[model samples]
Target: MRESILKRVAVSRNVLTMLVALWLMLTMNLPFWRSVWQGVGGMSNDSPLFLLSLPLFVWIWLYVLLSLLAWGRLTKPVLGGLVLVSAGASYFMNCYGIVIDYNMLTNMLQTDVAEATELLNGRLLLWLLLLGVLPALLISRMPTRPLTWRRELAGKLGSMAVLLGVFAVLVMSQYQPYASLIRNHREVRLMLVPSNVVGAVHGYLKRELAAPAVLEVVGADAHRISAVSTQHRPRVTLLVVGETARAANFSLNGYARPTNPELAKRDVINYPQASSCGTATAVSVPCMFQDLGRADYKDSMAGNREGMLDVLQRAGVDVLWRDNNSGCKGACDRVPNEDVSHLNLAQFCADGECHDEALLHNLQAYLDGLTRDTVVVLHMKGSHGPAYYKRYPAAFERFTPVCKEVQLDRCDTASIVNAYDNSLLYTDHVLAATIDLLRSNAARLDTAMLYMSDHGESLGEHGMYLHGVPYAMAPSEQTHVPMVLWFSDGMQRSSGISADCLRQQAGQPVSQDNLFHSVIGLMGVRTSVYQPQLDIFRGCMPATVAQQVERSELRVD
Candidate 1:
């Protein structure tokens, strides 16, 4: 009997081990496995200098383990219970005000679907199948181990203590490596985990998590512009926001494609070297348009009395926001805003759904066919998202061999770029069309169209696919964006902007912040609060006294 028992015990151990191995193998064949592997490697690479930070990693893992152990006691099935809880929490956060876009999901997955598929097609699947089958078979043959209530109780108490300890440390930790931990917290509100923990982790590797260099500014009275501009009437300016537009990808900026064919011919002043404030719309949009600089964005939002929109409105300009984005944040609160997302405006085109055109369709109607000296803001859903092909119509699909879908990594780099370029091509057409619309009323209107992208995107460079990394650590492909301004003929003549001179300064480095002053100046509005030193129009002053505006850097987290 003793000999038989020994053999049975040995068999049981072997069988359980085999079962675990098999499950692991099966998981490896799935996309989720690839995501885990890739994410671990990517996170590790981001902080290679701190690769040996064992103590830190151990602390985190231990904390998680302890929490799981405690939960196990309270719940019969603790491990599964914890995972379910986490998933529910994530869903709740997304369902609420916190936006969980594709970037967040993709980043978490690590390995893209393409890589996972490729691995499945190779030897990975075979090994996983063997492991998955062997483990279950062995586990089935083994006898169940009886559970001791006393021992389970002890484990639960011990785990709880450990979990609490870790929580204390996290709260005490200042200058944490990842701001994502904090940023994400805003959305998820996990008891301890921050929404931006991902970004915070990357911050340990790169110092780009701060604000952009351009907005490193402090308090300024709104009435400061009277000294610079003579005109006293309140000047109205409209800021046209472009989404996912890359400078190098636009034809106006010399992209090989004819993306901006119309804008290029219209003599719009394109700023070639303009960099974005952040990599994603969530980070960049708020930061760029916010009153505070990147470094102190949170503080600025809390402490500063007003944002760009607020400041302009305070100066008596009619600030109107027309958006085609999924939703508008508080950025448009001070002004009247219209949500154009629900409008069905694609009458001429059938292939592409209503996007940027949605915001434009009712513009004339919104204006009541009567021109108002109003500052109208048009936020375009231009080139937005994983499905590039879906953003544009077939007519604008001029660039062939394009990646119509978001599984960009599966396609060759050139083809993926071609698809993106085609989207840009569509963007160019919309912009050109907008210009023409404005020009048609130029005789009675002092209209100006200023186009600036929230951030740039990475096609497949450096083994990365999309945007949303901290800007400083991000590739130049993600930072450099295109900015072009279409000044109505009347405004141009009023500002005394020579056609030859304006063209000469086309390639200059002008930060988005400069628009704050230039717009007010061009409108001949004499606010006492505007800064002349940071204005680009100052650069265009008489060449004798013309001074180059200082290039400011933005901190991105």
Candidate 2:
């Protein structure tokens, strides 16, 4: 009995090793194989030799990867983890045409539990079970192989040398073709499994673990101007930061659909030529509030500096950030911030998620308590997708047969657009409600509202289903965002600017760069850091009034 048991144990261990090797060599490379096959199929009248060389190159690459993974006692566990992660990454890339890069991994790290849970679906579960869980189970059940330390060390060294040799020969044989292919089709390299995942994780770790620089305080000389009478009502400016709202879909920007009926009714100034600072909220949210423009913007530098909100607070203006989507991406770290996503309001929230309207709940009480000049920022969960249909209530679903699945590929293109348009409609309603709220408070405060989205979305355009592509390579559908402004009569008089003047400036090219200086100019804050050239309000204010304010700098003497 003992002899039989030993033989059975040896057989199971060998079987497990073979299974792991097959998974590493084939299962993890499924996406790469498919991409290669598709590329070859699209080739028109290509040489037979070139086609034959491609598969040979891929085989050598896989052999190197498999050899490197097949050493040491803990090899099974490490290979198992890689297999699972590769499977998950492959599914997302194949289904969504998304590249797993450092920015994407960073976005994943920043995702909240609620946002992460939305990605869970029956199809994902099925794939995980087939490709991940089964392999992991086999690995766990396999008995450990007993080997001497010397033998294991020697085996690892031998495998490393073999892989290096194979890689060197492959590079030498087809250096020119390989270089040209990688240079022209860079995205194809990003589709390679295990390498992309490992590189992305390494890059993310390097960024997160790097030593942070000293926080540079901007607008230290900031002080409110005294040109106006002391009895003038304090300003109440509401900065509505929208999510994933593309300008191409807004009727105010010449879309065929009337997506902005409510804002249209109001005499709002819609900037049709507006653009976003970045293509993802992870980058754009912080960039929008930073003093640096897009050309000089660096994510690491932005994280170590005081933003526009800090400058407003330093100037004795009250600043509040109420978030309905994910948190403020550290932009609100130094200010008073609220997360209203967990509120149990049945009218606005369901299944642990809430519409943008939830941010408006109890907002009046919060505003009434503030006596100083206030800058209130409401971060709305506007049109954030693959679950666009979940963003609004049933009443707002005017478009029929909307996509209800988080996996957008499963739905038809029309259904996807219908669902996205419905989300935009909801966003319109939310913005209109905010305008009404500001109008209601016009009697007591000089009220104004500014709305702009963090970034745009891509609904099945060019095989792309969502945003977060690198900005240089991103499409206009992911960069051109909607920006609208509404000013009450009280606000117009207090700021010494007219709606007509703002309308004229609306046609000029503007971006998130204008936001920092424009807000400070509107609030009448005098500081050396304020650049009049970048201020959109500078062109809109009366020439004499603008000259008087420009000369009325608060001297510290």
Residue 516's lDDT within candidate 2 is 91
Candidate 2 per-residue C-alpha lDDT over 1-557 given as tens digits, one digit per residue, 9 for 90 to 100 = 97567556753232344455456546656656665656555456254555556655655564456446655655677767877888798778767767777877877777788888888999999988898889787776666656676765665556557656866777677676567666666666667776788778878778766727677788888887765424368788999999999999999999998888898998899999999998888889988998777887776654677889998888778899999988888688899999899999999998998899998999989777767788999998899888898898999899889999999999999999999999999999998998998888877889899999999999989788888877877889989999999999998887788789889779888999988998988887767788888988777778887877867755322
Highest-scoring model, TM-score: 2
CA lDDT, every model vs. true structure: 0.54, 0.80
Best by lDDT: 2
- lDDT value for candidate 1? 0.54
User: For candidate 1, lDDT tens digit of each residue in 1-557?
Assistant: 96578565643222232233233323322322233335345455565533334234334443444243433233323323333333332332321112233343333334334222322322333433344334334444445333476654465455556655755555445224434433532322211222223233344324333424444322233432322233322223456888887787886677766778878787788888887766666556656665334554542232223456666555445568887664444466556898766555556333323567666775766554443245777877777645677667778777778775544556787877877887787788888888877776665555678888878877777656666654445677777888888777666554555545666877777665565566655543333456676456655655532221122121111
TM-score of the candidate numbered 1?
A: 0.65
Which residue runs of candidate 2 sit more than 4 Å off their true CA positions?
Answer: 1-25, 28-41, 45-50, 55-71, 140-150, 211-214, 228-231, 301-303, 555-557
* Runs in model 1 lying further than 4 Å from the true structure: 1-78, 81-237, 299-305, 346-353, 365-372, 496-502, 524-529, 541-557
